[model samples]
Target: MKLATLRRWFSPQTTMQGKIFFAFGLITFLSIVSVTGIVYVNMRDTIKHNAVTSVSDSIRQADESLNIMLEEIDRLNTVVVTSKNTVIDTIMSPNEEISYEWFQEQKRITEFLSVLINYKPYISRVAVVGLNGKVFFTGGPWMDRTVLGTPMLNYMLQNGSRHAYFKPEGAADAITVGREIRYNRETVGIVMVDLDYEFIKKTYGVKPTADSLLYVLDEQNGYVYQSESAPSSFAPSLEKVVEIKRKLAGQGDVMEQKINGRSYIVVSRLSEYTGWSTLALIPLDSLLSESTRIRNLMAEVAIIVFIIILIGSHQVSSRTTLNIRRLRSMMMQVKDGNLSFPKTEIKTKDEIGQLYRVFVSMVDELKRLMEGIRNSEKKKREAELTALQAQIRPHFLYNSLNTIKYLAKLNGVPNIEEVSGSLIELMRGLLGNSNEFLTLQEELDYVFSYVSIVKYKYMEPIQVHTQIEDESLLGCKVLKLMLQPLVENAIMHGIGPSENGGQVLIRVYAEDQDVLIEVIDNGKGMEQEQMDALLGSLDREDAASRFSSMGIRNAHERIVRMFGEPYGLSLHSEPGLYTKVEIRFPKIHHAETSAQEVV
Candidate 1:
C-alpha cells in the first residue's frame, strides 16, 4: 500500500502541490542525511586518533620510570666493581689461607653489602659467594648458596668484565645482577644483588583502569610482566603476544587491531637501559562511548527537524498555490462555454499578482486573434492555388521532351532519341515524390541515364568502368539522386575541360558491417590545396558554401540526413594523380532493407 501511494505521488498525473512538497522535502532530507554521515565518520576517526595518542603518552611515561630503575641497578654494579677497598680484594684473592685475616675480610665484606641494602631498599639481597661455597651476605641471606651459577663467574673472568645480568632458571619474578671482585688480574669471588618483580612493577607507576591493560615485554627473552591494575579480561592471547613482539622489533610504536570481538589500540615504548618494552591496550569502544551518545541524540534531532519541515512545507505550498487553483477554475468555466467571469484580484507584489495581470491582458487579445486567423487562412488557400498554377511549366517541358524523343526516333537518329529519353527520365526522377528512397540498382539506372545525356552533350571520349562485388547489395536501399551529382561533377570538372579525357570508375562492395562506394576520376586530378577546398565546401552547412557547391553539397546532406553523419562522403586526391570519393553506409540485406531504411 505504501509503494502504491509513493508511485501515485510521483506520477505525472499528481497535483502540482504534491510535486512541490516532494521536491523540497526530499532535498532537505538528503542534505541532513549527508551531513549526518560525514559527522559520524569523522567522529569515529577523531576518537580513535585521540585514544591512541593518550595511550602512547602513558606508555612513554611508564617506560621512563622503568629505565630509571634499570639505571639504578647498573649503578649498584658499578659501585661494587670499582671500589678501592682492599678487604674485598683480599677475600676474592686466589690463595688458600686459614688465618684470622680471612675472617676479618668476611666481616668487612658483610658490612659493605649492608651499606648497599640501606642505599636501595628494593634490592632483596646483597651477597658475595666464593668458589669455596661460603657466602658473605646481608639482607637476610635470602637466596640459597647453591643457586649461584659458576658459568657467570667464568664468563666475567674470560671477558674481563666486572658485572653481568642473569635470570634465575626457575624463578619467575626476580632477576640477579652480579659483579665479579678481581685481585691481581684473577677473579676470586662474585657479588650478587637480586631485584624482586614487585619492585620492578612498582617502577612503572600505572594506575587502575577499567577497560585498559598494562604489561611489560622482556626484550632479551620475550617474557611478559603485567601490572596490578591490568584487567584479567583484557589479557592478550599467545598470538597477540607474538604480534606485539614483532611490533617491538620494528619502529612502529602505535597499533590498532580487533581482538576477541573488541577493537583495541596498543601503544608501546621501549626502554633502552632495561631492554624491555612497555605496552598499554585501550578499548576503542569504551573510549568512544560519549561519541555514540552524541550520534544517537543527533539522529533524534534530525527526525524531529524533518517532521517540522514536512509540515511547514505543505502549509506554505498550499497557501502559495491557492491563486493558481482559482485561475484553473476560471479556465474550466471558459472551457464550458461561459463567455465572462469575475476578475481575479491578487494584491501582493509577487509572482501570483504578475500572473493575474498577464491573464487579464491575454484574455482581451483572444477574440481579436481568432478573427485575424480566419482571414489569414482564406488568403493561404488562394496562395496555394497560385503555386499550383505556376507548377504547370514543368509539365509542359516534360511533354515537349517526349515529343522531341518521338521525332528523333521517326527521323532515324538514335543518339538524339537516346539523349531526349534520358532527359525525360531525369525530369521524372526529380519530380517524383518527396519520400522516395531508391534501391542501389534503381539509383544506378538513373545515374546511367544521366551519364548518357552528359556523354551525348559533351561528345568526350571518356571511359566509364562500373564494378559490383556483391550482387545481393544491388537491392540495398540508398537516398535517391545521391550518386547523380558525383557523376556530373566528374564529367564537368575533370573530363570535359581536359586535353586528353580520362576514365571514371565506380565500385561498390560490402566490407565488414558496412557498404562502401567509391568514384574515381583520372582526368585533371586536383592538387592538395584544391582538393582541401572542395572537401571543406562539402562539409560546411552554411548557405554560402551550399550555394557555391550546390550539387555535391545537396548529395552529401541527403546521405547524412538518411544514414547519419558517420555514413557520409570523404575525398582524397594528389597532384597529377587520381581523385577518389568514398561513401559509406550500413550494409543492409535486400530482405530486411525496408525495415532498416530508417538507419
Candidate 2:
C-alpha cells in the first residue's frame, strides 16, 4: 500500500497533480536550458564575427584613402613632366653643358613645380633627375640627387611603365615615387617625388596599442612604416615575409601566426597604388577580450536563471498539487458514507477548484435522498422502496459520475474560434489591382473589416473608433495599403499582447493643405530609443529589429518620397501608456480612383 501511494504521488498517469507538475516542470527546465545554451554560443561567435568584420572594413578604407593620394601624385607627375616648355625643355636637353643659361632654365622650372606641390600636403620633395648631370627640385632642405647614380633608380627606370613605383627601402629614410620620363619615344630621365612616410601612417586609420601593431613593407621586404612600439621579433625576415605572403594567397586576407611562441591574428592588405603591403597584428587573446567578458557574464546569468527557475517552478507545482490533495481528501470522506457537503467557496478558477464545486453538489444530492428514505415506513413500503431503488440508486450513481467526467474533460479543450465572413471579404479585398490610390472612406472600410477579424482573437474585443473632422474629407485620395500597416502594428505590437484589450483611435483631419491621419492605441508603449530606430533608416540595429519595423518604414519612406520633406510618418510613444503613429500628405483627390471606393 505504501508503494502504491508513492507511485500515485510521482507518476504522471496516476494523478492530475502529478501530470500537471511533471509536464510544466520538464518543459520549463528544458526551455530555460536550451535558450541558455543557444545564447551562450551565439554571443561568443557574434563577437568574433564582428571583430573580424571591423578589421576587414578598416583595411578597405585604408586602401581607398591611399589610392586617392597615389593617384593625385601620379597626375602631378604627368602634368609637370609633360609641360610645354619648362621641365621637358630642361630635362630633355642633357646635350647642353651645365652653364649660366642652363641654371636659369632650372631655376624657372623649380619655381613652377614649387607652386604646384603646395596643393598636395603629402608631397615632401619633387625633383627632375637627369641621367647624365643635374637634379632640379623644390621642397624643404633635402638631398638633390642622392639616388641619381644608384642601381636601384636604374632598375625602376628601365621598367618602362608610366605608373610610379614607391621605393621605401631607398638610400634615404624617405619613401620615393619614381616614374620614367619618355620624350620623343626615348627615355630621358626620371621624375621622382619623396613622399611623407609619416603622413601615410597617420592616414591609415588603425592606431597601434600595446597588444596590437600595424606596419607596412615594400615588395623587397623592406620597411615602409614600422611601429616603434612593436616587439623586436615582430618584424619578420625576408624569407618569413615571403612565406607569409604565400600562405595568405592560399588562406585569406587574415590568418593566424605564431611569433616568439605567442599567437596573433595577422591581417595584411597589399595596396595596388604603392605596391606596398600593410600588415596589422593583434594578439589572439586581445582580439577576444570583449568576447571573453561576454562569455563570463552569460555564464553568471545562466546560473542565476537556473536557480530562479528551479525554485519558482517547484513552488508553482507544489502549490497546485496541494489544492488537488485537499479535493482528493474530500472525495475519500464521501466514500466513507459521510455525505455532508462543505461550505467552502470555490474561488480558484482552475481545474481542481471546479472539481471541488462538483464534488460538493454530488454530496448534497445524495444526502437529500437519504433523508427522504428515512421519513418513510419500511415494511408497508417495500414495493415503493424497491421501485425507488430501481429508479434512483444505479442510475443516479452513473449520472453523477458522467457529470464529474464531463467537467474533467471540458478543461482540456480550447475555446472554439468563430471565423466570420469578414475573413473571406478581407481576402477578396487583398486580391489583384488594389494597389492604386484609395479614397479615405474606402480605406476606413478596409480598416473596419480588418479589425472585425482581429476582434475574434480577444475575449473582450478591442474597441476601434474613427473620428473624421469633416464629412467631405472622406473623398480625399491617399496611397493604397498605407494606413492598414499602421493599424496592424497598433494591434499586434501595441495592443495584442496587452492583458485587457485596448482602444484604437483612427483620427483624420485637415491641417493646412495636407491630410493628417493618426493611428493611436491605448496599450503598452515603447521607449524613445526603440521608437527612433523603428522610424529611422540606420543599419546599426540587428536583423530582428529591422524586420519588425520593415512594413512601417516602407510606408513612411513612400509617403515622404511622394510628398517631399515635412511629411511622412512619425511615432510618439509614452512607455506603458500609449503609442501614436501619424501620417501627413497632400489632400488630393483623383477622379479615376473613385471607382476603387466599391472595393
Candidate 3:
C-alpha cells in the first residue's frame, strides 16, 4: 500500500501545474543535452581542421622570407662578377699601356669596391686574383703564404664553371663565389667573393612563435643554416628532403611532414640564382589553441539557450493573450461606429505593437472616408440651389430689358429700333443654352458684341480698344462667359463716375501652355481691401451674399472647377488709377471644323 501511494504521488497527472512543470523540465533537459552533444562534436572537428590550416599558413610565410633572402644574395654576386669583367677589359685594351701608373689604377679599383660593398654589406670580402696567382685588393685577413696559392684560381683556370662553395666546417660560416674574368676574348683574372654568414641569419629573423621553424638548405638537400631555437641536429632524411624539393621545384609551395614523432607542415621555395631550396616547418598543437577557446564558448552558449527557452515560452503566451483581448475590444468599438476610438499604448514594440500601429492607420482612413461622403452630399444640395438661382436671373433681366424698351419708345427716340435690336441680342447671349466650355474666339466675340452695345448706349464719351496676338490661339477653349463679367465689372465700377469717360483695353495672348487675357480700365479703381473682398469670396462659404460682385465670383468658380486652382481669375487695382483683371486658362485645341461651325 505504501508503494502504491508513492507511485501515485510521483505521477504526472497528480496536478495540472505539476504536469506542466514536468513536461517543461523534461523538454528543457533534452534540448540542452542534444544541443550540447551536437556542438561539442562540431567544435572538435572544426578545431582539428583549423589547426592544420594555421600550420600551413605559418609554413608559407617562413618560406617566402627565406626565398627573398636568397634572391638578394644572388643579385650581389652578379654585380661583383660584372664589375670584375669590366676592369679586365680596361686592362687588356690595345691602346692601354701595362705601365699605366699603378697608384691611379689602384685608386679606381678601390673606389669601385667601396661602392659595391656599401650597397651590399653582406659581401665580407671581394678580391681579384691575376692569372699569375697573385691576390690584388684583398679585403679579408691573410692566413699565410697559402692564401696566395688558394685553389680558387686553379678552379677558374681549368673549369669555366662558377662555384657557390661553402666552408667545410666553422662557427663563423661563409659562402664563396668564384668566376673567371674574361676581356677581349682572353682570360685576364679571377673574381672571388666571400659572403658573411650573419647576412643570412639577420635576413631570416626569428619566427613569431614556437610553432614555426625556418632554415636554408643546399642543392644536395643538406641543411646549411637554421634558426637558433631549432634542434642542433634537426635534419630530416635526405630522401625526404629530396622529395620535398622535387615537389616544390616547379610545383606546389607547401607540403606536410612528420618529424621525430611530431606532426609538422612544411613549405619549400627555390632560389632563382643558385637553385638552392628554402624549407620551413610548423607544429600543429600551438595553432589549435584558439579552436579550444571557441569550443568552450559554444558550450556556454548552449547553456544560455536552454535557459532562455524555459523562461520565454510562458512570457510569450501571457503577453499574446492580453494583447489579443485588447485588440478585440478596440475592433468592437470601431464596428459600433465610434470612429474616435481610444489609441492603444503598449510600450513593448513587439509584433503586437506593429499590429496596433496598422489598426490606427486603418481607423484614420475610415474617418477620412466618412468625411468625404458628407462633403459629397453637401455639394449635391448646393448644386441644386445654384441651378434654382440661375433660372431666376434670366426672368429678372428680361423684365428689366422690357421696361427699358418701353421707356425708349415713350421718349420718341429715333434710335428705338437699334436699341431694341441690341437688347434682343444681349438677351439671346444671356439666355443661350450652350455647353459650359466655349472656344476663346466665341467668348471674345460675345464680349465684343456687348462692348458695341455699351458704346452705342453710353455715346461717344466712352472709348474701348481690343488687341489680340496670334489669332490662331482663338481656337483654344475657355470657360463660357469668362470675359463678359470682367468687362461688366470694369464698366459699372471702373468707368461709371468718370467725367471724361474711361477707355477699356482687352488683350489676349498665349504664354507657354496657358491662355492669358488682361482687361484694364483707366478709371476709378478699387482699394486693396475691395480687391481682396472680390478674390477671397472663392474660399468663403457665404461669399456670394457678402459681396455684390456675384458675376465675377461665379466666373472664378467655373474656371477653377474646370482647370483647377492654378488657372483662375486674379484682380489687381489701385484706387483712382487703373483696375486690371487677368484670367489664365489651360490651352485647349479645337478642331478646325468645330471652330468654323460655332457662330
Superior candidate under lDDT, 1 versus 3: 1
Residue range 218-244, candidate 1, lDDT tens digits = 644445466555556767765686686
Lowest lDDT 10-residue stretch of candidate 3:
590-599
TM-scores, each model vs. reference: 0.39, 0.44, 0.42
Clash count list over all predictions: 0, 0, 0
lDDT of 1 at 148: 50
Pick the TM-score winner: 2
Residue 189, model 3: Cα distance from true site in angstroms = 6.4
Candidate ordering by lDDT (highest first)? 2, 1, 3
Off by over 4 Å in 3: 1-48, 66-100, 120-214, 231-240, 243-278, 281-599
Whole-model lDDT values for every prediction = 0.71, 0.71, 0.66
**Candidate 3 positional error at 182, Å:** 5.7
What's model 3's overall lDDT?
0.66
Residue 326 local lDDT, model 2: 76
lDDT of 2 by residue, 506-575 (tens): 9999988888998999888888778766766534454125224445677777777766788787789899
TM-score of 3: 0.42
